[model samples]
Target: MSRASPRYDRRVRLYDTYTRGLVELPPPPGPIGMYFCGPTVYQRIHVGNAIPFVLPLWLKRWLELDGYQTKLVINITDINDKIYDAAPGASAKLSTDATAWYIEDTGLLGLGRPDVEPTAVETVPDQIRTISALVDAGHAYESDGDVYYRVGSFPEYGRLSGQNPDQVEEQEPNARKEDPRDFALWKANKPTEDTWWDSPWGRGRPGWHIECSVMAEKHLGPEFEIHGGGLDLVFPHHENELAQSRALGHGFAHIWTHNGLLRFGGEKMSKSVGNVVSLREALDRWGREALLVFFLSGHWRKPLDYTDETMAAARAQWTDFVASVYDPSEERPARGWEALAEALEDDFNTPEALAILHEWRAAGQLELMKRGLSVFGLEIERVEPPAEVNVFKEARDAARAERNFEAADDNRARIEEHGWTVRDRPDGSVLVPKP
Candidate 1:
């Protein structure tokens, strides 16, 4: 491709945590493959867990809108210490149930799904083969039946996290480790842990980090355009994946894009602090558009607070967008969705894009506004008010024509009571269904 090609000139640029810079995305006609690290299904996911789910789905839609063929892969880690600890005897069943809940909950967000949602349990053979290759290459070691990655073998161990190799602290401390900083590739099964897989190391499950590496490779292959997750994964979870995959000579992801965590009451939402809000509860409270708009209110790389006040504001924003369709069309110079697209192209800045959406709405660029909202799955379908609403609307219209302002006001209140409002367009008064 020439440097003057649209691929080069209009390519999406995103912040890569690995490079610690805003980097140009590889231009496409060629498929852009993205791998997002998904939840470890020990329990039903929280609102914090849903950020990774929403960000990539939105990115994929935007890329497709820009003429790129995209494949998005989100992996589920069903085999992890969390699962074992959460459900001792029924770890497998718990993970299975939680995975189902995760799919059902995230599906409620109304965004289109990923191309692939591979589970760790389903890819054990692929993981073992990769781990064995790592062992053969002297990138890993076995001690007392457990397998661990030799961190020193990969000299660029802390490059992604920006910590010196010598300064990186031990992630998993076991006396049998060759080095204190080395992390588990395969953990030997415990007496209480019922979920075990047969591997070269022994009967044990793949470690948390290796599960993602294998699942990502199995679906998207050894090389891809982007690997994404929440900001919290930057250190050990993602760094380990980068080190292990690179050690095996796989090219892996070119860019690492992480979304900010969802915080509640000024702290990261945690079960320990008793502020954890389930995704289901959030969806139930705020509905799909408001919850999504809340996410859009903040840049993908910055923290967002989850409070009633914030959600209420998001709901109001969504109400404004929905109501715009009923108002008279103010045909201004067309934006063609380019202004919002420009915001997205410059590092996927969702908050700025959202502001542009508001501008489009205010400028009466309804068509452009709708086109932009669809990219983020914030669809606004204009529905007619019910028959009962029409009675009041007609009465209100007649009263206004007869110069009975008091009766017209009464009819307006009655219509609003039924969750419908009247917007007097240039054509006529239109009854719009309320949010």
Candidate 2:
């Protein structure tokens, strides 16, 4: 863990060959057990579903800045189908305490918290002891009270979505499923929705792809290291969670990645396409550092596109990189902040690490643009302004001394649209904006 700490660089090969469609798969050789596919809270999580919570919190903070040693888990399905269609009351203590209160409302959505969440109704007895050891090794089946999985008993079942469990069993089944490429792992207790209990396949629940193949084999085991989410769940939810962790013989994730999909004008962003928004209303109208510069402005596999002019150009490029790092202007130009630590050590090439942070803030170099905004999480800091902008510039100088020029031009355009700048003079006194 100390190879001269650049966090121990040189790793990043990355995968997602469009979800291993060709089956290459190889990445986790040392400490990297990730697993994301979380959240099914039936409501309020949007920011394009927190783009699978910031691409596994930027692949667990860029694989702990490359030194690895990550664990990462993020489960929480809370018994599927959008929490049984928004909780149609049933228990495992009400879908595992309502999906741990919708994943603590997504750890208050700034995306840095989750290390282990685990739900699917507290891993339904490890998904009924992993579908009773894949139905006593025949790779699963039950039928009426439901259990399934047999997509013709593995055989590299469509090798992660290249698709052909005999063409997904010639496509058509899905009534309660049996074999249109058999899926569910448990589900029987239907007196009319949600249910639970030590299942043999009776008091139902636990089937959305064996709750992340038994919570990634009970917390990142049976091989791990990267299995990210949302390139529209890479074909049939990570190819049926890689056929339920290779029908329980282990080895399901070894670099899968998947980000790309938060579009708006160019379409996509669905809540059945209402063009959904809500990362708690874009953090109550743009705040968590302009929602992490609108989720690091693209290339976590690509397709960005959201708008109100791309979140007012990512809140005017995070207010001109925090007013060019609080522009005190001592004229310190030399910046080459180790070329953004050599472009975030390549592979996390955030637009070439924001073009080495606009060539270190166009060379005025505010300490190499605050160490390239602290390795691209966008370092922030300089915000001040809210004394309510000097109480709206002393009520915009008592509304231009009561002549009330339209209430002093609406508190001088709301303190110059909250970034501030106002001056009125002619002895009326207003002046503010001088960060």
- For candidate 1, the per-residue lDDT at 43 reads 82
Estimate the Cα RMSD of every predicted model relative to the unseen true structure: 2.1, 15.7
lDDT of all predictions, in order shown?
A: 0.89, 0.68
| Tens digits of per-residue lDDT for model 2, 174-222 | 6766567677777777665746675766677767877787788788788
Q: What is the Cα-based TM-score of model 1? A: 0.95
Every model's TM-score? 0.95, 0.38
Residue-level lDDT of model 1, residues 226-307, one tens digit each, is 9999888988999999999999889999999988888897998988988999999999988999999999999988989999
After superposition, candidate 2 runs with Cα above 4 Å error: 1-9, 12-35, 46-52, 57-82, 85-133, 136-184, 194-206, 209-225, 228-247, 255-278, 293-320, 325-328, 333-339, 342-363, 366-435
lDDT of 2 at 404: 85
Q: How far is candidate 1 from the true structure (C-alpha RMSD, Å)?
A: 2.1
Per-candidate clashes come to 0, 1
